[model samples]
Target: MDLVNSFLNFVVPPASLLMLAFSWPTLSFINVCEWIYDTYFREIDMDNKVAVITGASSGIGEQIAYEYAKRGANLVLVARRDTRLRGIAENARRLGSRNVLIMAADVVKEDDCRRFITEAINFYGRVDHLVNTASLGHTFFFEEATDPSVFPILLDINFWGNIYPTYVALPYLRQTKGRIVVNASVENWLPLPRMSLYAAAKAALINFYETLRFEVKDNVGITIATHGWIGTEMARGRFMVEEGAEMQWKEEREVHVTGGPVEEFAKLIVDGACRGNAYVKYPSWYDVFFVFRVFAPNILYWTLQMLSTNHVVRRTSYIGTGRPLYLEGSPPRKFLTAGPSTQVPVQQQLKME
Candidate 1:
């Protein structure tokens, strides 16, 4: 490996320069033509379409339900919180949707994911789009981790959570030549401090879908949505510790919120998914930073270091005070809540009333 690296070090730079010189114009032209094609030919119709959305209880997911509802699409909303899901479904109906189904399921569980997708198909008859918008975020430095063992929760929820739903819904989606929209984050490709595991999961998500896109080869459309900061429940819900290794989750409090509105972000995401866009970067400005990440990594690293300082309030456990409990492989922690809840199948949390 060392010898291969040494050889590449000697040859890659010149070869890259030559390749860039020869391919730049062709690549630029192709990009221009692709943009034109997408702009003029791409069309997305939401009326009467059956759409399945995970993480539909709150944040961008909740707003996405409303946006799709406004377009007259039938929706199946999934989340761990049945109460919140019910509320969002009601709002979606008021927005314009004639039919809305709320299914409480954890995306990380294969069976739960299967049930969610199966229930959606059973209700709608055909599925036009499956939106994977479920994710979790943390803001602690790696060194302060009390139990690095608990880090897998991050990957399981963010990466595997997206994958499980896509896997189960693929067959139904293929029937309609349907689309899959994944809510990845800009942190996947960019340098961001204190979010190492979250970024890794997102990066994995991006790579997985990118590869899946070619494997499906026009059979199923895949749209990867990459977003930066947004004003949402996750933004204001911060974490704090009482003492050594004992983690305490804090209440949602606004402490310098920065980002675009979740509602607008949701609209853009829906529009992009329906248009079959390969990628969507929110706030538009994230594109510039993404470019800098590739070409000017050092500068990007320094900037992110500065940006992460605000999160370094104190040293606390990585997993938090909540004892890591995977109830039948599902974490005991409440979904999107700092407080813990009793063991129950997430799918049964719904109340039709």
Candidate 2:
């Protein structure tokens, strides 16, 4: 496509080719939307449909909850903080959602998972959708990181986190032929050097959801979003950045990765979920890279290492802070309090809740 786009760019203007490419995708999407409304939504109803979402307290999860609620989805928002969960539930109710049940259970617990899903079934009597967007993403060089021992902990949240929910919800999903949207990260493809843990966990999620779609093909539909970075709390919280690591958010002289706005990204996610898509990728550029990383590993990784901030950069101080490249202050979320939940630390809150 790049080569074709280049040839067209030389003949006409690059802008013209971009416009042509953009026009076709929009029309194709409309066709899919029509098919979905006819096959599922019109046949059923979403006015008070039920959706169970993990990691609903902040970042992408919160936005997804907002997007679904806007469409009248009765949400079961799961996260660990009682305060944050309650705040999100209230805001969702105000957003025109008919019912919003707040479940302050940390999905990391198996018992919590079974109970949460059971209650969701009893409360709304059906689950129309399930979105798994939770993960613990502290990464470092496998050897240098003391957190190497933390892999099981991360997996418990990232992998088992979605597993138990799917298990309990599956019987219901099979009944309703509900949709499942699992949030996998872009690193599932472009594995960054020091971001080993995050990449591995996300990769596992990708494989699980991909296979899951086929497993439940006759019943529920599945969509795996290999998301790129977005402007969310995960992006804002800088503590996770390792000292001297070359992150995408670093200065021009430093290494860094580019990202998209959170709401915009979340909107695309909702659109795909509504349509029951199989895969959803963003910034749209990474689609080709995902393929390249598979077929041309050597050249792709070598060249990307230069353009991307995947560690191995010249040594520097570990001082972490990024001057707001965009604007300061959180954007207004109508009736929404957007940030990490502070009612309790994730570990303690999950257990308490």
Candidate 3:
């Protein structure tokens, strides 16, 4: 009894509050890591506005930029990949954006965020939408995982990467009454096998976003795009590189409902912004489950656990069978062509035979 009480005392909110009081201002700044947290912190609408997207090279970030551009919004695209950023900027311009600026920088650094915000103000003359879409994912069994070093990198991109840009952009977002859209994963809501750390980080994002929604309800709109299954490039690469090297092409792609293509997913987000909704989910069935979680979390949790193990390869790749998986551009088929010398190309083999 004493031990349990002591443990609770150490971990309880009061203890945490005490620790925070003595700490620097850094802890509080974490709330802005992802869009969900910034919802409460900003005041803005998204239409015909300046939208800032982190990780704007590909996947959800690129999609968001395209969405805004089509709506005739100006853009500031931020990412580490200069080539991809330039491509997206050009596309944004073609898609009817008045102006597009690309910034190549890692969002985890405070200075980078400051630079991004400064550039946004200069390019668009104002700020509106701040979308936190940069994230990283890894595959390894918890028991087999052996990288204490990788955690910081993951948190930097996943947590701090989400926060820093939003922090620097908040004052601008507040002034413009712009919306903050966070691209948090559904794994944050439904924790699954082998992705414990990623899921936990997402859950923190969701919690922060939800609370922020309450705080900012009377102010600007805050939209949290808590997503599952949209077939982004990162998810596709992870699928193709399952277990590092093996490309198990025979499997059924480890998806429940088919994840939409990039353009389709982006449209849904545009619609969500139009509706002024707070929390949105993709592949709508999963959204239903997120709602069900409110009433019976245990039931919801087990149902997902059961659904995870039902896989095409019976869990052969990485993480177990029932774990959440994303599909790629489909399987690769081999062509055989044989030669007389038996040094036949697969295509040549087929032709000769």
Candidate 1: give the clashing pairs.
Answer: 247-321
Query: What is the model-wide C-alpha lDDT for candidate 1?
Result: 0.75
| Model 2, CA-based lDDT | 0.67
lDDT tens digits by residue: candidate 3, 1-353 = 99998888667756655675776366546534544544554423444678888888877788888888878888889887687688789888999898888898878889989998998898678987788888776544455433344456555667787778877887787787777778787788676665666777777777876777787674667777766666765554422322222222211233332356767767767657645667666765676675557545789877867777663122222222222233334365322111122322111000000
List residue ranges in candidate 1 displaced over 4 A: 1-41, 238-256, 290-292, 302-318, 321-353
Q: In model 2, which regions exceed 4 Å deviation?
A: 1-45, 238-258, 308-353
Predictions ranked by TM-score, top down?
1, 2, 3
Residue-by-residue lDDT tens digits, candidate 1, 113-181: 999788887888999999998887776666655555447767787899899999999999899999999
Index of the highest-lDDT prediction = 1
The best candidate by TM-score is 1
The deviation in Å at residue 169 for candidate 1 is 0.5
Model 3 weakest lDDT span, ten residues long: 344-353
TM-score of 1: 0.78
How many pairs of residues collide in model 2?
3
